[model samples]
Target: MCGIVGAVARRDIVPVLVEGLKRLEYRGYDSAGVAVLNGDIKRVRRVGRVAEMEAGVRAENLQGEIGIGHTRWATHGGVTEPNAHPHVSQGLIAVVHNGIIENHEEKRQYLRQLGYQFDSQTDTEVIAHLVHHYYLQNGDLFLAVQQVASELTGAYAIAVMAKDQPGVLACARMGCPLVVGLGEGEQFIASDISAILSVTRRFQFLEDGDVAEVRHDKIHIVDRNRQPVERKLHVSDLSLTSLELGSYSHFMQKEIHEQPKALADTIEPILEEGFSPALFGAAAAEVLPKVEGVLILACGTSYYAGMVARHWIESIAKLPCQIEIASEYRYSETFAKPNWLVVTISQSGETLDTMEALKFAFSLGHDKSLSICNVRESALPRASNLVFYTRAGAEIGVASTKAFTTQLVALFALAATLAKLKGQLSVDQEKQHLDALRLIPGSVQHALNLEPQIKLWAERFYSKHHALFLGRVLHYPIALEGALKLKEISYIHAEAYPAGELKHGPLALVDQDMPIVVIAPNDALLEKLKSNMQEVRARGGELFVFTDLDSHFTESEGVNVIRTPRHAGVLSPIVHAIPVQLLAYHTALQRGTDVDKPRNLAKSVTVE
Candidate 1:
């Protein structure tokens, strides 16, 4: 995913644009650039982080009151300075864009036929040239952007500025996200609210196919059909302190510690009133009762959260559940049923795969839909009929921590609510579940206390080239998440298998140097997991077990044990997620890798 930020203000906007890009650094980018307009367009582009671009801007002393900035995540070309955004056409117009333009080749051919030479190997360059073509004919920046937007196909959010019109900035959204920030005597547009939070909190979220014309004093919006439209302006409650990494070495470590508050914020509201279908939404009373089964669509850590929910839904609610990786679900033929509830999960609700999958489910006559998301204003939650906000705040780390655990809390609450709706849970049973949910925040705090021990485990893990993670039944998804975190940040080769499946094929890879991590919860599968651990030990693999406080597992030769907080029944998955996160964070620290932004991995997967 890329980040875009633009501002129309009275003061010099170069500092504001650069600071906005710095705030959006967590979204991940390979190259960055900024274009400003005074009497003419002055721009700077760098083939690295935003800091590099800032250095270039400083060296050149670029200044303007109107400008657009971008941090590009290289979708169409190599991570080169020329491929970075703020693409200029005929030295008159500069454009910064996010999302793929599916028909760029056709537009590029037409523009080349018009004798417009290309400068970079990016689809976004087509946008600049195309707008220039339209601007030449229409002599209006807004009309030019409107015409170009109508011609472009595929998901895109773009902001364009012309040197001829220094005070006007035109932006549009097709399928990707864009927001307009309302400030006193100034206006701003950014792909994310966090990017402009330092300047303004009041925002208008642009809908699909909406185009906006921004000026220093006013903003005008229009729909796809060129009809004037008004969007509701929302004042956000997010604080600047939440985005700061105070006293924490990295964002991953800070978010790992924030899980206790994040989980409490997610589930405490529902626990206060006990379990109720209305906790999801007002329509949950009618919509959830008709559900025959569940189809969960998600990607990455959110998909793993769905996997954990599948266990809870099937065992506790006695319902059939299916989990689909959102990226793959759209291409497969599905037997869609109307009564089945389609659940989509994402931390940033702008995940394109999951968003497209939700649309696919809607087209299949699956109207009973729900979205579990962290961002309230994101597209997925706005599109779904019922929404559950995870309230995880801003998850800045590329590898998820608080967002993942908060999703588990939301999914567990969904499982319990569905169980109550299905008449499978009695009053006392619901009370028991609610009581356990209430204790989760404290349990998460106890798990946070284990970071010292996990840091010790990281010492042993940083040197290992490969690792194997093991879990059984309810904990298998957690094992998968653990391996993902370790590999994502530490750059260690890690894999996970159900403990029973180790003998099938994964056991063959076990050897003395391989570190085998086990999620040995004291559940019904503990004995079977112990047998699987014995299989690894027989082959001289050292075991690193994250087990329960009362699991009775002791440290011995060739094996080490780290006891987590006492298991909290259905909420064990949320608690167990903490140590693994710590293990990954500290291991990345040991390996001297960038823990917050891993190599080549963006925080949000906005592109395919």
Candidate 2:
């Protein structure tokens, strides 16, 4: 995920802009840059973290009253300083962009034909040039942005600064994320609240096709027709204070422990409303009758949440689901028919893969699509027929511990809503599911207590170079996610295969030096997991199993099983996700790796 932020303030806003960029560094750190306007244009950009950009600013004293900044996860170009964000056009129109511009090639070629030249190999460069092109035709900057947005077809959240329009920043979102924060004599625009939390509490969640002309004193909202629209303000309950990890060594570890509270922040709000989604009337009715099949389109942890959801949705709603990674859904020949209900899950909401998948599903004729995402104005939400916001606050860590769990909670709620709408779930069935959901946070808290021992096991495996994660059924997805977490952050070679498929190939890789992490929750698959652990032992592979206290899983010579609290088959996904995160965290810590900013990785995969 690339982070994009813009600020319009009465006084100098460069410092505040840089600070906002720092908070968003977790989203991406490959490159950073800012475009600012005082009486004139000033740009500071570098191909690294916020620290590098900050140092350049301090060493050079780049000042401006209005500005936009970006931390880039490079898409089309190499991670060079010049390729960093805030790409400036030939006519001096400046822009900071977060999603890929798929039509960049055709646009770039057309612009080149009109005697326009480019500086970097970025798809974003076309925006700066396009805005400059629009400025020549339309006298107004906001109108120019609207024109540019109309021409673009792919995902994007763009902030533009024009030299002619002093003290004002123009921003628009189609399939990317953007939020405008209301502050005293100042206004902030960011990809997420985390960037502006230290600056402002009041924010306007920008909807898709909505454009804003943000100035120090006021913000003007305009519809696609360039007609003035009323702004909607949503008060953020998240205190920026809680975003800090305090004494914890890493954000990932802090988030691992914060799951119980995070779940509360997300789940409790639904419970108070009676019906799921606070649905009472037409919204409920509209959502209920339109589904033929459920399609979950996501990437990474969200995909795992979808897998867990396939179990619940199938069990409760009797709906078959096909979960597709967002990246592949577009190019594949497969399709969703009309009336196919698509649910896309993403934390940033601007996740490129998820956004692309939604567009693809819609393009394939699926008219009804919904997004369950954390960021309000994110692209996935804007493109959907319905949007459910996850109140998980800001998950800063790239490894993704809590965000994954909150998504599961939301998916479970969606499934439950479908069950109610279908009239398949009786009141007791509804209560039972709700009760199971209610216990998740508490169970999650208890699961966090096992870290002391998990850390010990981490010590044993930190030196090992390879690992295997195995499980079946719902736990199989947990196993996949667990291995992915370890490999993503720890850089260890970890493979997750269905336990049933382990012997087909992966069993050959087992050895005394190999650490095997098995999702061994006490379910129907317990005996299968037990047998799998024994197989690992027979191969002299080290073992780690997530089990219940009553399950007789003693620490054998080659096996080490950590007992988790016994929970429902549906609820085990919540409990089982914790240890995997802890194990990865501890392993990364032991290796002295940068847990937050791992190499060759950005928090969000904004590009394909």
lDDT against the true structure, per candidate, is 0.91, 0.83
- Cα displacement (angstroms), candidate 1, residue 527, comes to 0.5
lDDT of 2 by residue, 115-160 (tens): 9988899989999999999888986788889899888877788999
Candidate 2 local distance difference test against the native? 0.83
Q: What does the lDDT read for residue 291 in candidate 2? A: 81
lDDT of candidate 1 at residue 551, scale 0 to 100: 86
For model 1, residues 390-443, the per-residue Cα lDDT tens digits are: 988898999998999889888888888888888999999988988888888899
Q: Whole-model lDDT for model 1 versus the true structure?
A: 0.91
